[model samples]
Target: MLDFAIFAVTFVIILVGAVLYLYPCSRRASGIPGPNPADETDGNLQDIVNKGSLHEFLVGLHQEFGPVASFWFGGRPVVSLGSVETLRQHINPNRTTDSFETMLKSLLGYQSGMGGGAIETMMRKRMYESAIDTSLKKNFPLILKLVEEVVAKWESFPEGQHTPLCAHMLGLAMKTVTQLVLGLRFHDDAKVLGFRKNHDAIWSEIGKGFLDGSLEKSSSRKSQYETALSDMEAQLLSVVQEMRTQQESGTFIDSLLQSNLTERQIMEDSMVFTLAGCVITANLCIWAVHFLSTSELVQEKLYQELDQVLGSDPITLEKIPQLRYCQQVLSETVRTAKLTPLAARLQEVEGKVDQHVIPKETLVIYAMGVILQDANTWKAPYRFDPDRFEEEAAQKSFSLLGFSGKQACPELRFAYTVASILLAALVPRLRLRRLEGQVMEVKSALVATPKDDAWVRVVRRS
Candidate 1:
C-alpha cells in the first residue's frame, strides 16, 4: 500500500509538469514586455481582432509597453518596434532585400525567385527599378494627358453636383497604371473596366481571406477568388505574348521584355506593380482631395503656388521640383492618413533593438501607424498641417519612415509623381468642398480607404 501511494504521487507530478511545459501560461521567451498568449493554440490572435486592426492593436501595445514590444502571432513570436529611434536601428540601409516584397509574395503565394541568392535578388531589384524609371520618363506625357482628362471631366460637372470621389479616383488610377505598366490594350475602356473588376475581386479577397482564414472556410469565396486571379493572370499573359512580337515603346512591359527575365517573372512583377500602384495612387489622391476640401486655406495656398509657378504653362517633369509646397501638402496628407499603416521585416539573423534580442527568423513589425502619430515625433500629431513638413527635420523623419526621398519604395515614388500632377491640374481650376452631413470613416486594410462612397461637391474657381 505504501509503494502504490508513492507511485501515484510520482505519476501526477510528471503529468502536471508535462502539461505546464506544453501549454505555457506566461511565455516570454525573448524577455520582451507584452501580453501573454490568450490561448495555448491561438496565441494573441483574438487580442488582435478585438483591438479592431493590427495597426490599432500596435498603437495600444506601444502605448502600454513603450517603443519595443513583443506579442505571440499564433505559435510564432513577433516583435514590434513603434518609434523612430527603434526603426532607425532596425532598418539596414545596405540591406538589398525588400521586406514589402517578402510580405506581398507570401500573401500572393508567388514562389518563383523568392528564394534566390543575394546576387540574383540584387539583379532582379536593379532590373525592376530600371524598368520603372524608364517607364515613368517615357510615360510622363501620358500621365499628364490622363490627369487632364480627369480634370476636364470634373470641370464639365455642373456647379453643386455631388461627385463620387472614390470611384472617379479609382477609375483614373486603373487607367493610368494599366496603360503605363501593361500596354496600349488598356486604352480600350472595356478592357480597363474588366481588368478593374477582376482586380477588385482579387484584392478584396486577398485582404479578407488572409486576415481571418475565411478563404479556407468558404469554398465559393475561394473559388471566386481563384477565378479572378486566374483571369487577371491570363490577361497579363496575353499582353506579354503580344508585346513579345511588337516594337518596344519604353513602357514597363516593354522594358521587362527587353531584359532577360522569364515570361513568368515578367507576369509576376507586372501583377505586383499594377496592383500596388493603382491602389496606392488612388488612395493617395482620394485622401489628399478629401483633406484639401476640408481646409480652404490649404486649397488656396496650393492654388496660389500653382498659379505663381506654372501660370498657364502645363506642369512638366522639370517643373515638379519647383512646387515644394505642393510636395509638403502631399507629404502631410500621407502622414495624416497613415496611408500604408503597417510594414514587416523577417529577422534573417538574430537582431537586437534597444537591448532586446530578436531571435533569427522571427517576424519583426514596423508599427508605422503608431510612429506616424507619435506625439513625441510630431507637433499636435493629429493635426493635418502641411507646413510641418517644411522643417528639414520633419522631412528627414518622414524619409526614415519610407514615405519619401530615396528610401521610398518604387510604387510610392510613382504615386507621388502621379498625384502631384493630378493635384496641380485640379486644385488650380476647381474648389473641392465636402458634402454636408457626410461622415467618412476610414477602413484600415492593406491600404486605408473610406468605408463608404466619399462624396464631394465641386465649384469652378473663378
Candidate 2:
C-alpha cells in the first residue's frame, strides 16, 4: 500500500506536467502571443539563455509578439506586458497586491505559512508609509553624514585616483538603511557585518535564481539562504525588544513595534525593507552619479542648482522640494538607467485590459525598461537629458509605475528622498569625473547593476 501510494503521487505529478506542457494554460487562456512551446523543455531553452540577459530576451519577445507575450520559467508561467496601455489595464485597477511580492513570497515559502489577509496588507502599507514619513525627516541628517564620510574617504585617495563606485555606494546605502531599519549605526557593529555578509551571499544567489530555481534546489545554497534568514530574524527580534525600552525613535522597526502587528509580522516586514531598501537605493545613487559624472553640462547645472539653493548649508527635509533640478536628474537617471526594469502583478481573476484578455493567476509583468525607452514616449529616449524633464508634459509621459501617483511603492518614494539628500550633500563640495572612455553597461540583478561596476575620480572643488 505504501509503495502504491508513492507511485500514484509521482504519476499524478508527471501527468500535470505533461498537461501543462501541452496546453500552456497561461497563454492558451489569454490568447496572447509568445514562443510556440513556452516551456523550458523545448529546444529553445539554450537559445533563450544565449540572449545573455532576461531583459534582452523580453525585449526581443515584445518586438516579435507585440505588447503581451507569454513564456515559462522552469515550468512557471510569466507573461510580459510591454505597452503602456496594457500595463495600465492590469496594474492600475489591481492595486492591492503585487506580483513581485507574490513571487518572492512563493520563493520564500511565506504564503504557505504566514498570514496574508486584507488586514495584513493594510498593516504592511501603514508600516511602509509611516517609515517613509519618519525617514524623510530623520534620515536626511544621516544621509548627509554618510555623504561627508564618503567624501572624507575620497579625499584620502591621492589626486587622479579612482574608486569602484558600486562597492562604496553599496556600503553607504547599507549603512544608511541599517540605521533607519535597526535604529543603530552599522559601520562598527560586528553583528551587522555578519548580517551584511549573509545578505550579500543571499542576494548573489537570488540573481542566479532567475535562470533556474537552483537557489531552492541546491542544498548548499538552500542552507545558506535559511541561515541568513534565521540570522536576520534573530537580529530583528532583538531590535524589537530593545525598541520597547526606548522612549522615542524613528527606526522602522520601532514604528512597527508601536503598531498592533505581531512580532513575526514585524520581523518579516523588517527583513523585506532591509533587503529591498539597500540594493535598489544603492543602484539608484550609483547610476545617478555615473550619469552626472559623464555629462559635464548636467554636472554644471547641478552644481549651480546646489550652489544657488543650498550653498554650504545643511540639507533639511524642508529644503528638499526646492532642489527641483536634482529631482529631475534623479528622474532622468532612473529612466535612462532603467534602474527598476520590471514591475509585476498577479491577476487573481479573469480581467480584460484594453481588449487584451488576461487569464486569472497570470503573472503579468510590466517591462518598465522597455516602456520607458519606447521611442513614441520620449524624444531620444536613450539620451541622458535631464532638461527634458523640466516640461510638465515630459514628466507625464511615463508613469513611474510603482514609484508615484496612487499606485506608488512607499519605499521607492523614500529612496528618492534619500538619494536626493545624498546628491544635495555631495555635489556642491565635490567634482565627480567619469574615468575616461569607460563604458558603463547594465545587468539584471536583484536590481539593475552596472555590468561592470562604475569607477570614478572624485576631486574636492576649490
- Candidate 1 matches the true fold with a TM-score of 0.91
Q: Which stretches of candidate 1 lie over 4 Å from their true place?
A: 1-28, 91-94, 210-213
lDDT string for model 2 (175-197, tens) is 88888888754557575566787
Tell me the tens digit of each residue's lDDT in model 1 across 29-132.
Answer: 77789999898787787787777667777889998999999887666577889999999888433367666665565556677777788888888988987888
State residue 118's C-alpha deviation in candidate 1, in Å: 1.3
lDDT of 2 at 408: 55
lDDT of each: 0.79, 0.69
User: Residue 152's C-alpha lDDT in candidate 2?
Assistant: 80
Error of 1 at 391 (Å): 0.7
Candidate 1 collision pairs: none
- TM per candidate comes to 0.91, 0.87
Candidate 2 to truth, TM: 0.87
The local lDDT score (0 to 100) that residue 135 gets in candidate 2 is: 56
